[model samples]
Target: MAPGSSAFKEVVESHPKQMNHKTLKMKAESGTVKTSMSLAEKHSIHGVHELLQCPTCAGSMYPPIHQCPNGHTLCANCKIVHKCCPTCRFELGNIRCLALEKVAESMELPCRYQSLGCQDLFPYYDKAKHEKHCPFRPYTCPYASSECCVTGDIPFLVAHLKEDHSVDMHDGCTFNHRYVKSNPHEVENATWMLTVFNCFGRQFCLHFEAFLLGTAPAYMAFVRFMGEDSDARKFNYTLEVGAFGRKLMWQGVPRSIRDSHRKVRDSQDGLIIPRNLALYFSAGSGQELKLRVTGRIWKV
Candidate 1:
């Protein structure tokens, strides 16, 4: 292979192969070589790939690649936040690198999440869509009794919840729980309990919390499935709280843990009781709250 431009020379040195590439040459009327390439080598592919990277962010460049008068190039997004070329400090203008864009159109690349277990390859244009719905994407920890930021696959998260969060683990679809508070007025906007149930070869989380619903202090309880939204739709749960023949019931489908606990709580999709009603159900001291909550889960 013969030496071309500075970038082409680097490509030749890196990839030394003997394969004929498609002819990519151009000539102007004045006999001045606008573009010349005799890419009869295999080593130039990686060098061309490096040329598509934005010098500023080091990310792959797509369409509308901009350049400065000095020939320094950057992606369109970097061009917005910068007034001059990052390499040569030359004032930037609306100069598009059409040649590089054409090269990118001919290449295919792997997903950025390839290290995260996504073994898929796509054209430069189709990479983003595949990553959005990738099954191998990590899920956030569903433990809602605290501010936790752990994320991993489902099995790792289940183990983490039991060890790090000290969450209760049960083994049945039906459950009965009793919540007792000496000072109901002192309850703040916080989660009180989170229990996990292993049922039907899957897992579910039960959440109980106390928060201010508008100006009134209230209690809420709900269940969430430890899976995706589509699988969550295959089950239903009901919660009941009552005393002295008076009861409150809430029936709904379980939301997937994909929705954060705060999101589900803010939507108020659960059994809710005002402070006064809860105290009446306690049937004890005026300053005490002893509420019993029972729930059952089944496939629909």
Candidate 2:
């Protein structure tokens, strides 16, 4: 046994089986072992095995890696350690592991709100953006009490409020068909009238609260309903324009007065008066309506 030659023979002669066993044990403990049956295989068995185990904890790995302050590779459990990097003392703000991020990106994730009709899939990084604008996001209409049941995206909501929940805004007089005057009595010259009809068939009469001036006009209106007192109830439905001379004349004679006649007429000609009748208009300046109605109305 010459010097180097004797050393090599000794190494070869040593228990090769023991050496292999030690190597396998070490690799297994590190979660890096794989069955290499051939030089090439269907999948990279070692890489696949490693993929299944966290490089930091040597435990079962989840796809996305939550990271710490210092760019230390960590398993989810270790990654959450006081928000400090496990490998260094870096203070973490909001760290994310690119390696795990890439893994998550390659995997398909369904929208969190998918059950609510959101049919979008997104990579890990884009998840927040998709969630922010998902069509299934829940929202409530601002004018919910005013017969507006519309609900949807912000733009849709705004359009619904403008087109459906809007009340007829009047820029001119609601009666006399004239532009509203600086004084309520001055409104007598204007013929335009304003009214709001609720879904419940109740009627409200509107009048100018202050003089019409500048671009917008000030307005005031009273909502009237049947009262307990007969006298009060007698004028219960009266929408008086006062000095403005704009009056909404409902069929003053109640059904009690015309019921007999109406019944006879219906028996003869089948004519009927609608139970709920109301009108809508703009008073002084801005005029718009949320619902359709009948009546010869105009804006002054």
Q: Report the backbone clash tally of model 1.
A: 1
Candidate lDDT scores, in order, read 0.75, 0.33
Distance (Å) between predicted and true CA of 146, model 2?
14
Evaluated at residue 101, the lDDT of candidate 1 is 90
- lDDT per residue (tens digit) for residues 92-161 in model 2: 5555576755664554344556555554445434555666654455444433132445545434544554
Residue 117, candidate 1: Cα error in Å is 4.4
Q: Point out the worst 10-residue segment of candidate 1 by lDDT.
A: 5-14
Total colliding residue pairs, candidate 2: 26
lDDT accuracy of residue 221 in candidate 1: 93
Q: Against the hidden reference, what TM-scores do the models get?
A: 0.78, 0.26
Candidate 2 Cα lDDT to native: 0.33
